[model samples]
Target: MLNRHIKSHSQYKKHMCTFCGKGFNDTFDLKRHTRTHTGVRPYKCEICSKAFTQRCSLEAHLRKIHGAALHFAYKQRRDKLYICEECGYATHSQEVLHLHLQDNHPSSTFLRKASKKMEMTLQKKQGEDQTENSTADEGSR
Candidate 1:
């Protein structure tokens, strides 16, 4: 085989944790993921004052509040989605999964009306389809 010099991340440093021996591409990621084992909360939400151990969780919260569609779009691209064991709801990211666990399985309150929106849209679309079919049948007759 000919020599193939495929370049990789030049500055990539495998930040390894001595406890688990797992490696990451970035030191910041290793620091952040280490909090899972340490049970540390570094980010706090200003709106609800809810604190999270991970920045990813905080980002997901903000995205859910301000960019739900964007977040959903990002989720559909995941290889395997995470489902809530408590409610069987699927999430693409760890943050949303954690949020679902907190909201459904723990002592947490919902700030958004997810069920109301889904119900209203479902009913409205059903009514529109029924009316359209009825009108089309009448016109054909």
Candidate 2:
């Protein structure tokens, strides 16, 4: 409604894009528009690790890209609270939750260590096999 009204009248454009000379009446509108030229992403999705310049864009990504069932926080305020799926720990910060998952979650931490061990074992076996092959070739010569 505001955009329509602004467009109908030659609105005094206060906000201007740095990259382009395009003018916007609202500062928020100008910032959101400027992201297109700057390729700046300030907001990021915790689930998929996708980034977006605008908060609305990130919210839209959660709905359309992630196919998440949208729920209003008014009705489900407790659900809005970030809780660990692995443990019962709760935190508002996403970075804290990510650290908690990596440090405290048994599956993630253990699996990472186990995977590294397995990779090292495989590499050692390959090195031994190569050495044996080289020794055999030298002996035959």
Candidate 3:
């Protein structure tokens, strides 16, 4: 992490924001900064419907404003939220997002293709898990 931070300071910024021409060493930082210009607040509060550009900002809002406590196990990160770019719909599960896209935004070709890709990846992962289990079983026997 220290090395990454050091690299960010020393290295030339490769990612540039089109709106303001601000440069960032990291793509994630560039995207986050771009959101400030685009007004694309992806992270939203479920209770108040207030949105934020970053997930951490939303989490802080939930804790401070809504009096919500976010509990995570030691060294465990929060679940990656699947957010709908079309409607600001957010979910913890990709399967839920796939169903949401199918039901609400059937006309979205890009989202549909993304859902299919996710499904294919999941199927591949399941196949790999089964193969590993079978190999382990053979070795144990």
How many Å off is the CA of 89 in candidate 2? 26
User: How many clashing pairs does model 1 include?
Assistant: 0
Greater-TM-score candidate between 2 and 3: 3
lDDT of 1 at 141: 92
- By lDDT, the better pick of 1 and 2 is 2
lDDT of 1 by residue, 1-141 (tens): 121122124344457765587776665466556666655564667777776765468769877875633344544553544434333455566456666766666642221333444458679999999999999999999
**C-alpha lDDT values of all predictions:** 0.58, 0.66, 0.80
The candidate that wins on lDDT is 3
TM-score against native, each model: 0.33, 0.43, 0.62
Worst 10 residues of 1 by lDDT: 1-10
Can you write out model 3's per-residue Cα lDDT over 22-138, one digit (the tens) per residue?
Answer: 888886687678777757788878899998988889989999999999887776877788766556677888888888888889897537776787979899999999999999999
The pairs that clash in candidate 3 are: none
* Candidate 3 global CA lDDT score: 0.80
Candidate 3 lDDT at 76 equals 83
lDDT of 1 at 21: 74
